[model samples]
Target: MCHSQDRTPSEVGRDLVQWFLENQRDLPWRRDYSPYGVWVSEIMLQQTQVAAVVPYYLRWMKRFPDVPSLAAATEDEVLLYWEGLGYYSRARNLLKAARLVMERFGGRVPDTEADLRVLPGVGPYTASAILSLAYNRDVPVVDGNVERVAARLLDLDVSAKSPEGRREVLRAATQWLVPGKARFYNQALMELGAVICTPAHPKCLACPVAARCLALRHGTVENRPVRSPRPRWEELRVAIGVLRENGKIYIQKRPEGGLFAGLWEFPGGKALEAETPRVALVREMEEELGVRVKIVDKIGVVRHAYTRFRVTLHAYRCVPDPPGQIVRPRACAAWKWVRPSELDLFAFPAANRRLIQALRKAADAGS
Candidate 1:
């Protein structure tokens, strides 16, 4: 295997920049570059495809145009814009970071790497990306695509998931970064990886840096940049209760600092072993809302797959029992009752979204 020293950094930089200028995709974030736009796009791009994030990013920019605008918006309003984008913590952290930027940095995004790192959800990769891409700093970014391209180019033997492998890839990327041209060079590297050096069936022939890629010479381009095995998927059975009273459905805000944080959902929880869906719904509603409910009928089931787990949601139509008490927030942060037509004002998880649609349809049919 050849080391990164085999190829000259200047040569790689020139080729990459030239290729990028000629062949970069016309993305919205690339046009009229702003630090806020770069930060938001970077967060949204995490674990989400480019095609999916494009429209969402456009909508977010329109609604929350600047850091002050984002900080001024409510959490519910922010999540409403980010409803379908999974990994909701990114949205929440963006809100936190925007507020911090307003208070700490005087409403302007921090330009220095150190200050940027201290912002919520702004890690090393994200910090480097914002500094280099938005501010044109001489910093290196080693995202998944960059790591894969660098590993193949340097023919690193270790998996990118390992610390040693990550360091080596970052070193290679840093060495190749063109001084005073980080904005273009980093984007070029990522663009090259996305279009040519893909994980499967990489188009090495079309790659601009094919001549400098060590894996190509070693006949191991496809096998380079190995990753560790993914975690096993855990199956969960959840019971969601659609409790209604006076033409309003009951919903609760999830607690902060966990999965689906700050989003709204039907009152429910994971079913215990051997517990029936009906029993689980009753227990969960009582525990979450502090109100007793009787199952009126079974609604429908919705299945959703998260990054690490798959859940089967059993939904049921329920009504508050006699001597209905004021719903209290026991397990959640807040509780509310809203008409089916008003659900769009709040953000809900994908599974709960399906349930909401079902409820709306049922209400319409009954009417």
Candidate 2:
């Protein structure tokens, strides 16, 4: 609604930074201020909450503390560490970037913004964060929390993801970013939004820069940072064939460079609007595995949600029609038959993990 930085930048920056120095949380990343730790923490924090990221961040640092250590890890092990975090592509890209850092940057996280931008997962925001927080570069960073603080401070109304909104927020941030004080200023601004200036029911009284917030003065704090609504979660129906023979279960690795890339999953696909899920299972097996399968029985259903889709997986127990056929993978990377007890060794999607758990429970009940 309203616009302008009515308060002095020096005054506001001092108050925010002072408050931060006293109240900032003792996060693991902040404990050392290492470039590697900052980069990993920033990537993990995207689309994830601080509380959820803490334990995962801790475990990840313990296992792969530096660029060289991470570069040496297998993709499967990286995915395993990232299992429940969701948006697994982040983890994949992070590992890719780590290897690149070793080969291209001499096993050191790049310091220049341009060099950081060339990495797989490092974008403008992430680059700025690493530069400012890790290298003590005098560059201002704009993440969700920082954007929120800027929006309320300047009463910005456009979507933060949009170009115009970004420009406006950056303008406000630069104004308040004290020279050579980027590390403390940026973190302080974000901390203010994360704690006192939250989207819902902001604690205006406790905010360090409350006197300077245009939205608070204009009585529009709740509606200051406008964001476009997320796309509706479309319901996606899928079928998976869990082929079992001689106490071994069949699983296939997904082709690389797509969703769930390189992860092991049962072969199956979506049903045509006119066909049943079982019908889809037979077709998928023939197409993906190059074998005709008879759907012997329904296994179970598992529901999982991604960023844009809510998937309902219908699993089936299937057997090759001819009892034995040459195994071939037409649409997948590889195929293998493992004992049911060995399923836990492979990294699977959350939905497939649920199916595995159910099957394990059934075997336990029968035994």
lDDT of 1 by residue, 1-367 (tens): 3365577888898889999999999999999779999999999999988999999999999999999999999888999999999889899899999999999999999999899998989998999999999999999988889989998998888898688887788777888889999999999999988999999999999999898788899888888887678899999999998888988888889888778989999888899999998999999888877888889999999999998899999999899886467888687788788988889989999999988898779879999
What is the TM-score of each predicted model, taking all chains together? Answer: 0.93, 0.92
CA lDDT, candidate 1, residue 18: 91
lDDT of each: 0.90, 0.88
Candidate with the greatest TM-score versus the true structure:
1
| lDDT value for model 1 | 0.90
lDDT, candidate 1, at 234: 100
Instruction: Please list the Cα RMSD from the true structure of every candidate, rounded to 1 decimal place.
Output: 2.0, 2.0
Give a tens-digit lDDT track for model 2, residues 1-367. Answer: 3387878878888888899999998899998899999999999999988999999999999999899999999998998888778788899999999999999999999999999999998899999999999988988888888888888888887877688998887877888888888899899998888888888888999887787788888887888788788898888899998997777889999898888987889889998888789988898888887888888888788899888889999999998898887678888788799998788888889899899988888879989
Question: Lowest-scoring 10 consecutive residues by lDDT in candidate 1?
Answer: 1-10
Error of 1 at 334 (Å): 1.0
* Candidate 2 backbone overlaps, count: 0
